[model samples]
Target: MNKPLAERLRPAKLEDYLSQQHLVGPNGSLQQALKVGIIPSLILWGPPGIGKTTLASIISKESNRPFYTLSAINSGVKDVREVIDKAKQSGGLFTQKNPILFIDEIHRFSKSQQDSLLGAVEKGWVTLIGATTENPSFEVIPALLSRCQVYILKPFSKEDLIKLLRRAISEDDIINKKSVTLKETEALLRLSGGDARKLLNIFELVVTTESTTSVEITNEMVLSKVQQNTVLYDKTGDQHYDIISAFIKSIRGSDPNGAVYWLARMIEGGEDVKFIARRLIISASEDIGNANPTALVIANNCFQAVTTIGYPESRIILSQCVTYLASSAKSNASYKAIGKAQQLVKQTGDLPVPLNLRNAPTQLMKEIGYGETYKYAHDYKGNFVEEEFLPDEIKGTTFYSPGESARETTIRKELKNKWGLKYNY
Candidate 1:
């Protein structure tokens, strides 16, 4: 009932903040930034509980700046504006830096919500710090992302977790009063899933499960307490990705029941609607490509629809998309073709276009034999011609092979008719 052990032991200063040495070490960029008196807007991207929030707090405290925090999970444009307005009022009083506006799980914020922060960050009304577990490149809008510095926080190293366990037992007022001995930590660390806060929470739970004055933590003790009290849907942890993977795989495997079940799990967990819609889009292309070309259209429209209509209604839209994709015929031919094409490109860098295939837009290009011998497919019989389209070196290459699905079968037949054995269709 008292403050959780993780909260009780949260570091108040940078020196006390554990790990992330690359960012906070003596030779680190952030350390130098604080020393040199320049604090740019930042995006802290990483897994759960590696001191992202704590570090943000330490930065605000060290600089003596007014700090405002927002969770993109629940906060909206109105909430962001209200916080920015308060920061702007107090920003003038502080000369060292603007008031800090820190948003946790910032990847959950929509385009408009993120746009609301742009003006404040641009005019220096507040210094924006956004934390995200997902890759900011995919989740954050480019305009807002461009204005911030991105620092990746890795999961705590084994050594760092050990240091944290030792520190908690020795330093925390509530934990220390219990006088627990961390005799073994392999299970404790494992159950924590490389999360610092998880490690401490599990440690606290293992020791404090009983009212005994002295506690001994072992692998069995850690597991016993944890299995009894572990949360099922930790939205910020591994379960989030696991359930989404299940949902995508279910759709790909054409199991509407499984797909909808996982979709419900994500929806019930308060997963971001855009995140679900975006994944559905990728699944449509990657798994349901050409076999059912219309799948992508539905997924795209689903993304657009969910973006306009959020939450409860968005869940309905997602359900319809999920079930439709699950029932659609699946194919990966187009996806594989592009992947093979990219690999070939990387292997042969900047292969020159064949002269006949090159566009002769200017007289000089035409004089250089560009388009000189090119066969205009339109002018040819059946609107097709058997000419070398690829560069001379890889002329006979077949990067795209139709899958065994019906649509791709038709595509293969058409190519076979046109190119004979050239396409290996």
Candidate 2:
């Protein structure tokens, strides 16, 4: 069998693992766990090729515990249950130290899938080590998340990448047989985007593709070799964020063509259908707020439809919603209003509500002036009454300014008429 350079060069021990010193150093967070052989359930969150899997393997090896690996990309609840059952039998049944179960891309697991692991984790049937590139707080269930210690992994620095390249040349038998000198690394590092496995694998490709023993790797040579291999959509790398950025920008810019094109890119790339729909829903509110109130309704409906009907069919519903959002009038008035309100609340902490605005459920509360001088709009003409709504301290503040659109222009006119000089914008 032919093994890739990344797999071949996988570090086996903690001392051999590079970078992530905060998690594994002698004075690191896991120092006691590794030394005393008491492993806790942990969640390792970071960008790809940063040694989450390698660190888990090293911890297992150092602690002399059986290691079970599962990739969330291919594994489901059944696979998780089978592994946990086997782990329970292995050591968790008769010992305090449970076998370590390492799960990669753990963020992809659904709520039910995560719920299934709760019993085993709580009972010490397994010491779980979950790895994810996404933020675990949002992806992992609160119950599951609370049970594990989440440690963030940083990307490898230029100095670390250089060390890895030299180490590969010195250690790997294939590369050691060839005369591969790291003459220039700027192109290699830039293309790899701080991913250690990508950095090493790209270096290997540059060396092996040369077909000659004496090859001095240069920036120009590395770029030429890696240009064709660069992809536009990698869920684990920069392309994932970049493409989504473009998708949102297109919708916000009101370019239906661009929006649909990027949507197709995400759909073709097998992105989580729910993930795409969720972004669309946010964009609708943040980018197209009250300018066209129906946009939010449509975006919400699209989200529900896509969640219920996934894949090839969901693409049509998403495309429809994207075009509608792109064609609608844009405004961030609601988005801005909420932000300003939050800032004001922070500045004026727990300011007392006006007597008119306070609710009085009891006679004593009403006697103390709660609900005093409150106007009933129905008793006034046009069901409108001008009254003190804000606190006396900041009574004349204006937070919600209507955007310039046919719909909001009408709303602004109505407000000015109702408040007279108070809303005389």
Candidate 3:
């Protein structure tokens, strides 16, 4: 049988594992558990090609448990139950010897399918290990998610990827037969996008395609051997991040046509509707802001609607919201204001709240000058009062400068009218 380079290079023991030292290191969280041979039901969350499955396999072997595997893309509730039944027969309940059930892409499982595993997991019939690229809080059902401890796997760093490449060349039986030199790796690293599997696959392709056994890998050689633009949209790869960036930028730039085109690409590529909708909500606030307050309401509704009505139908809702946001006036004043305020807080660590602004609920607190001499805005003529809200030390700092949009321009005039240059509005 012909096996891929990534599969053949998979590490069977924790000592052979490359990255994720925080979890598998000497004093790591899982290190103690692995040493004692008692593994917990866990949800391994991370990007693609980051060793989630391999880590799960190592845990099962180290714990000396029977291993059962299933892919959520193909398996249904029935398949889940069958595996659980065999696991129950294989070992005792609540024991370290319980079978380890590994489910890849557990986020893809529907509510009913996930519900099927809850009983098996709760009874300790199986030590469930689920791997997901999506956030478990959003994708996994709450009941099932609460039952498993979530361990995040970080993306491979540039140094980590380079170490993996060197290990492959020196250790692989087939590759060691040939003389391979990595003259350059910029193109290889860029193409892999921090994914180890993609990196090795590209490296192997570059090596095997060469006519001679002596392979000298360069940026040019690697790029030429690997096919570019083959994948229209890779949900697990670079296109997932790049296309979303394009889609958001198009909206921020007020190009409705560009926005809809990128949206179409994502929709056709099977990008998660909720993921697309969530970005639109952020753009509505951070990009559109007070320029058109209605944009936020529309974007928020788009999220609620799409989550309820998924796929083919949600695409129309997404297109409508995308076009509306692109056509609306834009502003980043609110976003910048919060950022500046946060920076100020960090600089002036926990300044005391002004006495007048403090609430006085009891007689003892009232005597301490809380709410003393504080003017009520409602008692004023225009339902506004010139009160100092910020700490006295940073009293006159102006963080929010209204953007040059019609609505915000009106707001600028109002602020200038109220404070009379106190904030230099």
- Maximum-lDDT candidate: 3
User: After best superposition, candidate 2 residue 168: deviation in angstroms?
Assistant: 4.0
| Clashing residue pairs found in predicted model 2 | none
Q: In model 3, what are the clashing residue pairs, if there are any?
A: none
Window of ten residues with lowest summed lDDT in model 1: 232-241
Q: For residues 248-345, what per-residue lDDT tens digits would candidate 2 score against the true structure? A: 99999999999999898888777877778888899999998889999999999999998788888999999999999998899888898899888988
Candidate 3's residue-wise lDDT over 29-84, tens digit each? 89988888778899999988899999999998888889999998789988999999
> Model 2 — which ten-residue stretch has the worst lDDT?
231-240
**What would you estimate as the lDDT of candidate 1?**
0.87
Top of the candidates by TM-score: 3
- lDDT tens readout by residue for model 1, 300-387: 9999999899988888889999999999988898899999999999999999988888888899999989989988889988998889
lDDT of every model, 2 decimals:
0.87, 0.87, 0.90
All candidates: CA RMSD in angstroms?
3.0, 3.9, 2.2
Location of the lowest summed lDDT over 10 successive residues in candidate 3: 229-238
Instruction: For candidate 2, give the lDDT of residue 417.
Output: 90
Question: Given candidate 3, what's the lDDT at residue 12?
Answer: 95
